[model samples]
Target: MLDVLPIFSGDDRITRLFTLVPGSDFEADALSAIDALGGHTVPWSEACDGTYDLVVAASPKGDLSQLRGPHVLLPHGAGFNKSIPHEGSADSASGLDPAYLRRIGHDDTPIALHALAHPHQVARLAATDPPAARHAKVIGDLTLERVLTSAPLRDRYRASLGTGARKLLALVSTWGPESLIQQHPGLPAQLAAQLAHDEYQLALVVHPNERSLLGTYELTERLAPALDAGMILPDSHEEWASVLIAADALITDHGSAALYYCAAQDRPIVSVHRGGGELIPDSPMAVLLGRIPQLGRAEDVAETLRAYRPGAGHAAAQAAFAPPGDAVDRLRTEIYALLGLTPPAHDVAARPLPLPAPAMRVPAAFDVHVETTAAGFRITRHPAGKALPGHHLAVEHGAADEQLARSAGLLYRRPLPASAAPVDLAWTADGWTRHALSAYPGCRSAAALLPSGECLLRVRGHERMYAVQTEPRPERGQVVRIDPAVALSAVHARLLSPQPAPESRTMLNCLIGERTFRIVLRPATDTEATHVI
Candidate 1:
């Protein structure tokens, strides 16, 4: 039997690619739809141990050099197209680090199976990186294929969102500091307010990174007006896909969401500018954006929505990336060829797998147990204990010296246990911390007590854990207590610095027992204050 491991990092789009192939085991960033796909989930480190027949990754960042077997590069989206400015230009090529390009380029690269979206991408890779071109095979867009083939699923999704008898418009959000929503924070509500509720419904599908950076409460608050206006928020990739299919028109920033939606549904799209007036020069997103109607101001969104036309630039976008709906079959054939196995008979009648539940913020990798005690809480790790043949353990957080057991579970005791002492925690704009914490004796979990008296518990690699305050007061330099409870494992906080350095900045004032701990906030020098959050 062929052992294939689909490795997914933080990108949820990569997870969608897994839905195209059933029965393939996955090593994802967390417990995700992969679990529903009937494959056991393993850590990326374990998956990279090179035991599988093949490893498939969406991004080029992972350490594939250690792989004992061949690995494939399944891009997260369509590759850069000709319309993308400077993509094939020698000037752009000259600007890139040759060493970095060589590492990711075709020649002497680790990628054994590189899947391209179209012939244009293949040709570009050949000219830019010949080795990559030699290994490249055009598989088109798998996500678009899922959208095109799964009509019944789309109907169910629309019904689930209660979007009936109403023209739906999807406002898709992307990550990055200067994303569309970031550029226009009130765009969703502004647009929703302009449209007549009886005629059209609005839905917001935010990129996962936005939630990570802003925290759930802040993001919810930012979009509160829209949600109150009956704008549907589809939290999972499956739901988002359905929203795209159900939407008559799409409003997006400079992200692949617009491109994917347009290519798959052939719907009209309204692109919003990112950062300054200029889009990312020579990018596919910029190229696609140029072809469609755009809105620079929130006030103009209403007019754009009313005048939008479906099938605008759909044929050209489809030709550039989404070639045919047989991408899944083509990918399977490639996988079989790579593994030296015969392709299974195609099942034309097989309906696409039902979309799994929306992905959760904290992936279900290990069972996290929180035991509240007088001194604080005891956080323990209980492995699923399933027999994952040829798998290992890799922890994304915590002390580097701390060892992960391949078979045994870990017990995190409060008060700093000598065996697992010296836990380090770092906070950033992104919700999750960099390292995991191993409980020691007297080592209680730290929390950021919101001004509303609601406690936000700390999870090692998550930023979405928080109790909603009935009345929220969002302000700058508002002193909030930081509580250290035994029940909490890690404290997740987002620090927003919109201006340059002052001498002293107070992040949060924590009141624990009789003492108060003042946390200091500082940003790296020379970077813009806006860049911090």
Candidate 2:
């Protein structure tokens, strides 16, 4: 309905009424989704008897005959390929369900013109319900076109997702017992464990049906590991399309989202569970999956991800959509024709998808990975929930992960600015002069970075924590900033010798990944370590 909304541009020209056709579990989310778009909705129970020129709905649920008008039934999802229970008794091809179409009349005619995405669907309907097929027409796919047309705005979408430098690898799962999350609940967390947190951003793309069924609390619990590892979870259906455009690659199961990915774009893919799902035997989704590079749950996830290159054979899925680029104009014409009115404009087009604002969580604790480079220390981090081998653990004070805090090798609290992502424990710092190492008795060393980009460290036995800043103080904004958590990792490495801390006025080069900070270590004077920055 939003696609052809432009044709009915004048407010006084057409009175647009929206209502929920409640049936599936997903209807619970429909109201909020409509609210987000600022669309006024009438209660489905109350709006049932109202007469209208035409009713544009995506589903065949409820008594559509109540509208007292012609209808245009759009495919609710990327052209339905999965079989579903129909009318509570029998199994039927999802979109081409004969029972649903026959609900309108005795001769197998549907209440609305069955708008399909491809010719294959028309053929599928012809084979099953020939009477309904006669009313069906290929109107191309609006969602697919939106995903493809928004290609130029990938950078904007990626920026909104905060995916800097890292390629976004989305875990696209459809809803069902055979879905990826149901089959491999640990995959997202485990995959995040495999990839460097600094090098990649992992996202979990869940269908509305699945989200509605699992509930946020339960789904968050199941994918906690991945969430702990900083996996993104998008809230609305529109955001999913933007994420698809922004995504560099995908790790998917046999859902329509994956099929759409294959049709709309040629990005790299890693398929999970090749033999699962109640897919239509010769459906485009089934044919493509029977041959994509497979990722067994027991196999090394990182290796599988790196091995699956883009441009693998997905011809079957690519052929799923017909006349895709012309969906907007074609859709407008189709909708207006039902109203018996000429379209306002012949070349009506859809805009790029809205920017995605994913639910992002910053992991406070990390198993800090360090290497002694010639310049100084090179640091990388993994979420402490599932640390890799040989990682030196660092947990912030009062972190949600208590076990990590107790077992951490280095613990510190730094005074952080607003809108900052903590490195070590930069988010918490009450004071500096009154600060004592005894506060973190479980760790060997405690450290902090001041608001002015100064590094401070306190060895366990030291009377005063050292104030380490570059001489003449560092300049106000350098491209590669320092995280006290990362700086402390380098400092910990330097203090491993008899010198438990950097000597006064001694210049040291500290490197954390691409960021290099030059600092002067000094034992804080009585007046210097007495006040907080």
Candidate 3:
């Protein structure tokens, strides 16, 4: 509905905007969004008493016979891939379900037009309910096209999401008992616990129906753990389109998001809850699911995420839509014709998705395990909120273990204040000893990670603390990337080793995730380390 608002933005003579409340199962949900759009909402009883040029609605549920007007039925999702399981008189195609379309005793569809997004829907409608098909028109998918149009702003979305250079794995679930969120409630946090937050980003895309069904307060509380472990949830349903645009891959169920994202992105999808196939068997989604991979609770998330690719059948996914990038133009033409007016002379193009403003909470504490290997350094980090076991605890300022006594832990600076000097970004471990020891009982090492790919380290047992920062000199033609926390953990492993490396050697290798960095080590005094270590 938000997608089509711009078409009516300039129409002055259309006068009052009155939304008919036809009592859908998700009526309040629709009304809330309509309320956001700002309009006078009229209930069905009152709506039938008045006449208008045209009326539009997304859901076909409930009795809309009392709503008198030339009705335009819009696809709330990607051409209804699900069956109307509970629409009485046995299940039927969701969008063209006949029983919900006509007046209680009448045979004809009250809707003047059934605006579909694909040719396939028109054909399906014709086969299942010829009356609805007579009014169905393929106008392309306005939402999907808008997402496709926003491709050029992918980086912008990534920035807004704060995912940085990491591959974003989006967990998209629709509302229902069979949805992924309902089946595996902890998957988001569990999947995130497998990899360091710095190496990969995870987010949950929930259907508005579920959010409305459970109510925002309850749904947010349900996602508390995932949110605390750095997973983001959009502020509103409309922001989800941009989330799809920013995703590198998808972990989806049998929802419309899976269908639309498959069409817009070439990235692979790992289907969760595939067993409950309530899918329209011949629908594009069902066909795509047959070719895509399914994930079980026992499957290795990291391995699947890194290895799977949406190989082949991309054309099949695209065929579900009525061409791309021109939905706004096509939809506007159909709607204007219904309003008995010319679609303003100017050309129409699908606009970029709205900027996503999501509440993203990062892990405040981590249980880090660092090992010295011949390959370099192997580092693993898990959030403290999870039940996973860790040998060492690394806590931040406001983390759960922030006040816990740590005999041997690594302590680092928190995010710098706005007034902090640029040099404050990196400070040596020795000078930080006072702050670290006071903060953590057995603080052995401290580090200040820098934005310029440098880490200033101070190991207490070493002779004099160094004030110099270490810079990487990648092995010939190779680029060095550093995950600061991982880098600090690697340095901790290096310092606490059974047989430490010879201090005389100034150069060493450190590995984090799959990337290796060649760092130069040096010996410096605390005063010299004040600027950087």
Query: What would the per-residue lDDT of candidate 2 be over residues 1-533, giving only the tens digit for each residue?
Result: 56446556643667877888666677777677778878889987777767667777776656665655677777866656677533421445576677666665332223557778888888887988897788788988877777778878888988798885567988888888888888888788777787766667888889888888888888898888788777888864678878877787888887878766676677777788656436767777776666566887633665676676555535756557785678777777777776677765435466678898855677778787777767866667788857664446776765547777677777766564455545533222325323434544567776666667676666666565676664332444424344556666666666754554545667677654444667666776665554454
**Which sections of candidate 1 miss by over 4 Å?**
1-39, 81-101, 104-110, 152-156, 274-283, 309-311, 346-533
lDDT of 2 at 463: 62
What does candidate 3's lDDT look like per residue over 237-268, in tens digits? Answer: 56787888888888887777776677766886
In order of appearance, the predictions have TM-scores of 0.55, 0.80, 0.88
lDDT, residue 396, candidate 2: 74
Candidate 1 per-residue C-alpha lDDT over 1-533 given as tens digits, one digit per residue, 9 for 90 to 100? 01122212232322322212222223231245456556555554554443555656554433445444566776664434212233333333221212323444333335677776777667766776676567788877766666667755665665565554456888887655557667778887776555544345678777766665676678877877666556777754456777787777788876566776776666567877643432435556656666677787766765776566655647446545846667766776677677676644434221352543321221112333433334332333322221121111222223222433222122221222224437744232222211213342221222333233333333333333322121222335443233222112222212211232223332433223222333333322222211111
What range of 10 consecutive residues in model 2 has the weakest lDDT sum? 425-434
Better of 1 and 3 by TM-score: 3
Best by TM-score: 3
